[model samples]
Target: MTRITMREAISQAMWEEMERDPDVFILGEEVGVWGGSYAVTKGFYDHFGEKRVRDTPISESTIVGAAIGSALTGLRPIAEIMTINFAFSAMDHIVNQAAKLHYMFGGQLILPLVIRTVGGGGRQLGATHSQTPDAIFAHFPGLKVVAPGTPEDAKGLLKSAIRSNDPIFFIEHATLYQTRAEVPDGDYITPIGKSKVHREGRDVTIVTYSKMLETSSKAAEQLSGMGIEAEIIDLRTLRPLDMEPVLESFRKTNRAVIVEEGWRSYGVGAEVTARIYEEAFDYVDAPIQRVAQKEVPLPYNRTLEQLALPQVEDVVQAVKEVL
Candidate 1:
């Protein structure tokens, strides 16, 4: 085992996958010369050369379209959009084609493509650059959405996404690039649609992932000191969401609190809260509480940015309300 930052972990994951599979190649804006917007692929250009690590123009639609075509032809293409917000420009390709092609063709073809993008606030990158859309891609069927919280999870999950013969949206937290953790060496991969019990508790279950997982874990620690044990279930994958663990946790605790970094309405929290109520309503001792961002355009101001987003205190309060 070795300690590394999330940025290094991500870079290593893609590098190793490309080295392991000759068909795997990456293309995106600034991925080559600029080393990626967040430096996630800094050395990839020189190491893999321009052929494998191709850089495209600043067109999200073109990047995604090219990836779809590349995938159909047998090349495993990992398309990187600089930010999640810009993915809208490529919605046609992502939603209509890449997502529906396999089913549309009666399962005769495989679309082994991965879309990598960074999201979440805390960098003061303004509203356009730092938006959390973990739930956005989940709305569409056939797209595998995942957001990794720790450096280790990032490495493992990315490796799995690249190998899967399906279209995947791998979302990364913009603020988590520097966070460090120990990642095991050698061959390893995290399952695509499994949620882990990050911190087991008895009083309440806190469901969260990605950047919010950090906040939820901190809130769980604070709750523990107050005589309330909050179990943290990290929903690493948003779409094809695994609810078995969530139902089990709610059945044990008899209370639930969902923590998400996106908007409160129609967000990941809303979906999870509804599922818990549907499957585990009889086990609930209290109503499910949610900790999420305020409903408004995310402000660019540093103070306002923090105000609009979910905080550790918010998670603590939500947990208390549910308990």
Candidate 2:
């Protein structure tokens, strides 16, 4: 295993997959010439050439639509939407077409399509550009939604999504590109719908994913100083959410604090909390607490934006509340 940044891990996954399968190609705004908005596809243009790393106009609908068309013709296409906020423009193609094509067509039309986009509110991208609407996309049945927290999961999960025969909405956190972690050596692939335990503890269960995983891990360290051991469950895949790990951890800890970068109401935390209560209510020692962003449009001001988003202190406080 080698340590690498989340950006490098993601880029490496796409690079390796494209090298292995000629059918796997990428299309998006600025993906070819600009090397992608977040630089995740840096140097892909020169490496893969125009045909494979084709860049399109600044139109989310066109980009996603073209990807669906190519996927129908037996080409596995990775469609980048630049940012999650812009995904609303292509909702029809994403939710209606790409997601339901295989199922609606009686499994004859296999869409090995991956819709790659970035989310989270950091760096003051404003309310419009900065949003974590992961739960909204995950609500749909046919689409597989995945958001990885660590570099290892990012590389492995992306490889799996590219190879899967279903449509996947891969959400990357905008602020986690530079975060580094140990990733396996070549040809590694993590299953799409499995949640993993990042840290083992008996005091409390802290569940999170994407950028919030980093925040919760920091909070766990601080909680440890206070003589509290927190077990963190990273929900890498949202749609086919593997709740077994979460439920098992909760049973052992008897308490939980669900943390997310999105709003608390009707968010990931809400869903997870509901499932825990439904399945593991007997193990509940305290009312589950949720640490999430303030219900408001993220501000352009850096200070206000940070305040609106969930913080490490927030997670710590939420964990304490549960205890």
Candidate 3:
């Protein structure tokens, strides 16, 4: 095993996939020459040549539309939307067209494309840029949503997204790119729609995904001091939520505390909580708790931003309340 940062892991996944398949190509603003907005795809253009690593204008709609068009024509396209805030401009191409293409065209066409974007609030990118819009894309059918929390999962899940036949919305938290972890040496794909239990416990289940996994893990450590063993489930794929593992964990710990950086109203936690209440109602020993952002635009102030977003202590307190 080799330790690598999430940015390096993501680059390796796309590089390996591009080298493995000729059909795989990348395009987006600042991707080819600028190495992507956050430098995630740095050095890709020089290595893959200009054709494979083409750059486009600063148009999210055009980039996603071209990818969708290329996908229908049997070319595997990987496009980046710069940020989650900018993706709203391409919702028509992303939701109305690419998402419905596979089923809308019967079983003839398989739209294999990936839209990579970044979102998180640590840098205080203001209210618009810091929005976690994964919940919106996950709401639409025929689209796979993936948000890996670590280097290992980032590498593995990116490879899988590149090879998947359906359209995939790949979200990378801005603050998690530099996080280091041990990744496998050879080719490996972390199966999407599968939840991984990061910790074992008998008290409460802390179901979370993406960057929130870090906050949840820290809370778990603090909760351990209080004799509370919080089981952490990273829902790496938000679309096809892997609730089986969650249900099994719920059987071990009859309470839950769902967490997200997005708003509490109709967020990812809301969907997962509904599933728990519907499928595992009898197994639940208490009202399902949630730790999420306050229902307001993320403020520019550092202190206010941190307060709006769910913190480690917030999760710990929520778990205590559930217990």
Candidate 4:
């Protein structure tokens, strides 16, 4: 086992996949010569050469569009948009074309495209650059949404996403890139729709993904001292959601508090609450609670921005409420 940062694990996954499969290639702005905006692909340009690790113009729509076209023509392309906020410009290609191509053609074409981008707000990028838009892609039918919280999952899920036969929207938290964790040295693929129980407990169950998972885990630790045992479930994949584990956890704990960095209204937490109510309402001991970011444009001020997002205190308060 090797300890590596989430960014390094992701880079290793991409590099290994490109080496193992000739069909796998990557394209994005600053990806070739610049080595990506966050330096995730720092040495990829020299290792893979310009053809496979091609760079694109400052156009997110064109980048995604070209990847979709390449996938349709039998090439596995990992298209990286600079940020999730910029993906709005390419929603037509992602939602309309890449998502519906196989279904509209009656399963005639297999779109094995992986669209990877950074999301969430911790670096004070303001409203334009920091938005967790995974819910937007989860709302679509044919797209697979994934947000890995650990270095191992980051590496494992990227490998799976690249090999999947469907279009995948892989969202990475901008703040989690440098976070380090141990990753195994082997060929491992975490199934897309599976949820992992990060920390098991009996008093309450806290469901979250991406950066929120870390926050919730910290809250859970603090809660543990107060005699509140909280189970933290990391929903690795948003779409094709594996609700069985969630329902089962709710059944065991009889309480739930969902944590998300996105806005509260109609966010991923809302979906999880609805699903829990629909399937395990009778089993729940209390109303499902959600700890989400306040509903407003992410402020540019550092203090306000930190307050606007969900924090360990917010999660601890919500868990206390449910308990």
* Model 1 bad stretches (over 4 Å): none
Model 1 TM: 0.98
TM-score of each: 0.98, 0.99, 0.98, 0.99
Prediction 4 TM-score vs. true: 0.99
Off by over 4 Å in 4: none
lDDT of 4 by residue, 170-226 (tens): 999999998999999878878899998999999999999999988998998899999
lDDT of each: 0.91, 0.94, 0.91, 0.93
Query: How does model 2 score by TM-score?
Result: 0.99
**Model 4, C-alpha of 222: deviation from truth (Å):** 0.4
RMSD of 1: 0.9
- Compute the lDDT of residue 232 as modeled in candidate 2: 96
The numbered model that scores best in lDDT is: 2
Error of 1 at 30 (Å): 0.5
How many residue pairs collide in each prediction?
Answer: 0, 0, 0, 0
Taking every candidate in turn, the Cα RMSD to the unseen true structure, in Å, is 0.9, 0.8, 0.9, 0.7
Extract clashing residue pairs from model 4: none
Poorest stretch of ten by lDDT in candidate 2: 98-107
Estimate, for each residue in 1-323, the C-alpha lDDT of model 2 and write its tens digit: 99999999999999999999999999999999899989999999999999999889988998999998989898999999999999999999999998788888898988889999999888887889899999999999999999999999999999999999889999999889999888999788999999999999999999999999999999999999999999999999999999999999998999999999999889999999999999999999999999999999999998899999999999998888989
Candidate 3 Cα errors over 4 Å, as ranges: none
Query: What are the runs in model 2 whose C-alpha is more than 4 Å off?
Result: none
Lowest-scoring 10 consecutive residues by lDDT in candidate 4? 125-134
